[model samples]
Each structure stands twice: as C-alpha cells, then as structure tokens.
Target: MARASPACWPAPACCNADFNEARLERYLVLAHAAGITPVVVLTKADQADPAPYVAAAQGLSQGMAVVALNAKSGDVAALAPWCRAGQTVVLLGSSGVGKSTLANSLSGGTLATGAVREDDAKGRHTTTARYLLPLPQGGWLIDTPGVRELQLTDVADGIDVLFADLIDLAADCRFRDCKHSVEPGCAVQAAIKAGRVDARRLDSWRKLTSEEVTNSQAMVAAKTRAAGKFTKKSAAKRRPN
Candidate 1:
C-alpha cells in the first residue's frame, strides 16, 4: 500500500546535488512517500558520468525512472513515456548540475536559466523559487531551492525504499527485532556471511535511520520550548488589558 505522507514537503523542495546528497535524497524520498514519483535527472552530463549516478539512483529508488542528458539544449521528450496526465515531477540537482538548463529544455527552450559563477560554476540561488512550469504536453515540473543539508525527521520507510535490499534482508533475521548487529541467525548477517550485502550499505542505512530519529526527537523538544515561550509572551500581553 502507498504510505501515508504529509504535504508540508512540496515537490519543488528537491536538491540537485551541489548542496548535499543526504538532503536531496530525503526530499526526494518524502516526495515519493507523498505519492509523487520523481524522475531522477542527472544534470551536468558533460562533467559527470550520468551512468554510475543513475545506476545508484535506480538501485535506491526501485523502478523509478532516471534520465541523463545535457539540459543545455536537450529535450526531455525521451523522458516523456514515464509521465502521465496530472502527475507532478520535480527537478532536483546541484548548482552547476544544470537544473535550469534542463528546466529550460523541458519548457521548450524559453526559460531564462540563471547563470552560475565561472570561478566555481555556482548559480545565483532563489532563481527558481518554487516556480511551476507547465509542460505543453501535460503535467507540471516544480523547480526548487538549492538544499545544503537534509536532516531526516520522519523518514523511516523512505530509508527502506532507498535501501530495499537491506530491508528485504532485514525481514528474515533470527529474531523479528534483530538489530542486524550480531544476532545468531540474523539474515542480514548471513548476507554479510554470503558476502552479498556490503556492510557499507547496512552502515549507511543505520546511520541515516538513527540520525533521523534523533533529529525528530530534537525538533519535537525545540517546538515544545518555542511553544512555551510563545505562551508566556501571550500571557504577558493579556495582563496589560
């Protein structure tokens, strides 16, 4: 079943990469949970090898479509097969990754792409600012901000989707609650036993999950503190009356 997701995280909030992978991945995962399937576009094709990146993304996203081409004058029509009526696709990427270039191409080569600095090839952000571009054919694409750090708060299943292999292996642990640490009959351990699942993948999943849980707790605490302060301010204001 499609998981329940909140709308606070709009599609436009995706990170291209010039920012941080963890952040971009989080936003993308949220979008996925929220029922928005993203087309992973590997920008800066001239500079970066889109193959390895797309390969990793496909492995993480599981059946999600990823297309890599020069957005400078490239057409997204090749990616059209994946789109259907009333779908929302967001373009996320780093600054020099040519997000605008691809957006312009998708927009029929009319969007004035914000140019990046030559010294570092960094674009002036706030250029997109959550603008929704309509595809002449159908559907819409949301261009979002450049994300620097993506802190996980409510992403447990998203991690599983991003790391399906580890999750699938996790199910068969000797104990249902095996932490995959060093259990006697841990399925994950057996994979490590069979030399199939790399320990790095498990480590990455654990790191992301732990960090997300911690971040969620801290955010809740901060919100409580802020609410207390706000309540105090309101009480003082009412006293004058």
Candidate 2:
C-alpha cells in the first residue's frame, strides 16, 4: 500500500511529442484517484537540461514536487524523503522513461533496462510484470509495466480535486450549466482571455471531464447488464423441475 507514486518521464535532449502535458496530467489524475501523492520524476536529466522539463511539470499543479535526475547514476537521494521506512512508492510512466533504472537505483535490484528508439523516444516493454521490492531504507517500491494508455473511470472526485481552480472559476459563470464556449459571462473564458488561466489547461480539463463522464456511464451500464444476467440465471435455476 504505497501512499506515494513517482510518475517518471524522460527529459529528452529535444522536444518529445510522445510525452506531453496532457499525458502527465492524466497520470496526476490517476494518482489522485488512488489517494496517492504523485512525485513527477523527470529521468535522463544528464542527457539534457532538466530545468525546462522541471518547470513544465511544476506548472501543471500548485506546489507539486518534481525531481530531475539521472536514474542510472545511483544517486536518487532526493527521493529518499518519500521512501522512508514503512512507506511504499510505485514507479509509473510509459516505456523507456527509466522506470526500471529508477527502480534499480532505489531498491538495489538489477531490473532489466531497455533502449528507446531514437526516432520516437519510445522503448520496448522491458519490465513485463509488476514487482514489489524492498528499498534500502526499509520502505517498499512497486514497479509496474509501462502503461501505453490510461483511461479515466470512476475518478470524478479525483478530477474535481485536481482541477479545483477551474472548478471554482466555473462556479462564477452566469449559467449553472455554462459550457464555457461562446457563453455569456463565462468566468472560465474570461479568465483565459484575461491571462489568468492557460487556455490549454482549460481544454485539458474539459477533455478529462468529458472522458470521465463517458467512461463512468459505460461502466455503470456494464454492471447493470451483468447484474441482470446474474438475476436471470438465478431465476432459471429456481424454476428447474
């Protein structure tokens, strides 16, 4: 039961379209859903200047903890505060972001590492399964396979918490159901135009909100169908000769 999860991302020498802000925000939402405080760990800092990557990550949330380091250097002491005794940390990121390497550094385990493609910066799935290893500081680390896609379901509360600022701003809109698009007295839109909020962030919030609603409805429908099938099967068994 880890209370903290470090979401890893590689600080590439050049811009990597694969690892974008939207993807990172999704990870944050997932972490919040799981009641875990996420630490944004930007790996491969030695390959490039980590300042830009660090700043980008920090900008996603207020007072977010971000660490940039060379995971292979075996000097991940900056993460020790979260890896203290009795605590557990899970490594989460896409393939080739140095999750395995970071796991090795923290837990002293020889987890296999892989190389990323020069073209896209994506890597092979080196860690095929999830593992829970003990850290040197008496804590535990859960290393999971790199996730290719993260779908939002049953995380409405988490999303609300992550985007609290936007939620608050939306409350000021003239209409209770204002879509914030071409609506009169739309606080969100006003903020975007006034330079109070980043338009991209507003877009991200909308996308995540829509996705969460759709996925939640689908899940409920699936469960209702499953329950109906089970009830019918029970009725059939009771009516047997």
Candidate 3:
C-alpha cells in the first residue's frame, strides 16, 4: 500500500491536531496487517520542507520506504519501482494528496485536478470514482476517491508487523502478559525511558491497537443490526396477513 500526503498540506486542526499523522499512521497499520508493502510518499515536496513529514512518516513504520516529490512536476519516476510491469498499485490517501495527479503522470490519463482549500489545505474530491488504467511503465494504477475516514478491520497481523520492534522488546518483559504500560518489568517502557524508543511511537502503537478493537466491534454491531433487520423483513413477508 502506497500511503501519501502532501508535505505542507493543511488539515482541520480542530477535527484532528495532526491530520497527516492520523491518516498516514492508520493507512500504514492497515497496510502492514494485509502484508502489503507500504510506501509513504510526501507529495508537494517542492513546495515545503519534506524532511520533517518524511521523518514523522518513517518513524511510524521503520524500514518502510518513503518518497518525497512534487507530483505536478510529472517527475514521479521515483515511484517506478512499484509501477513496474504486471504490478498493480492502488492509490490510497485522503483527497488532495496527489493520487489523481500521480495517476495521471504514471498512466497518461487526463483526470481533473483540484486545488486544496487555503484555509485548511484540504483538497476537493477530484477523483470521484474508482477506475483502473494502464501505466505507461508497464503496470496498473487503481485510482479511487480520497477517503474521509479509514476504518480498519481485522488487522492484527498488520499491527504486529508494523510494531515488530516493540513486539520483540515486549517479549523480554518479566511477565507473560505484560501490558507494556506501567508494568515494572516492561522492557518496552525501559526502552522508552532510556531514549531508545520515542514515547510518541509507543503512544501511536497503543492508539492504533485501541482503534482496531473499537472499529472491529463497531463492524460486528453493524452486521448484527443488519441481520436483525433482514430477519424481521423476511418474517413479515412470509406472514399470511
């Protein structure tokens, strides 16, 4: 999964303090769980300092590939490795991060582009539909509308993969079921206190875990409600009255 965001893209601060952090981390978590290779691309690099955003993104997923580019420059050849022949890459990110622009550059399609809101740096939903197109470099590009909210489901494996380093540290904890929070013998916490691991990264891990559980439960509840509705409808239709 290639997760992208603009280097200096503005986001609704009241809605979410760090828009890129929240969105990019969620995508990375989901992608890792699905065994997908995550490439964090910071578009509009030419417009702003891509370093901090790139660092923040890389911190979320160590060893993951990250790219910074000016999408409009049509110089996305850096993404060629993923767009190789017979390979299919899906564009995933919020609106205005340049998925459509990148798709156009790679696939030679004339998709409409939109300007990001000056107030919040949010881009309009330019790519309204999902479509697959042939890449000039011998691959397929699936461009879909920018998602407002990305609710993760059944991504336990991805979490493990994303936080493998922390997981490895957790195994050395004195207790078998260490929560890694306020545990006396928690190696994970030791690493944090020792400046070996960023406290923010640990917080991110915990946050994502909680979100997955919450989302999974919500999905189950939704299905249950839908099933109940169907059952009632079927019973009513079968009634002689």
Best by lDDT: 2
Give lDDT tens digits, candidate 2, residues 12-113: 212244547888888888878877777888888777777887888878888778888888785589888888776778888888888888899988999999
Worst 10 residues of 2 by lDDT: 6-15
Instruction: Please write out the lDDT profile of model 1 over residues 103-136, one tens digit for every residue.
Output: 6676664555666677765666644476777766
**Candidate 3 weakest lDDT stretch, 10 residues:** 6-15
What are the per-residue Cα lDDT tens digits for candidate 3 across 118-143? 78778889999998888787777788
Clashing pairs in 3: 32-158, 33-158, 85-138
lDDT for 74 in candidate 2 is 55
Query: What TM-score do all the candidates reach, one by one?
Result: 0.76, 0.92, 0.83
* Model 2 superposed RMSD (Cα): 2.9
State which candidate, 1 or 3, has the greater TM-score: 3
Ranked candidates (lDDT, high to low): 2, 3, 1
How many pairs of residues collide in model 2? Answer: 0
Residue 200 Cα positional deviation in candidate 3, in Å, after optimal superposition: 1.5
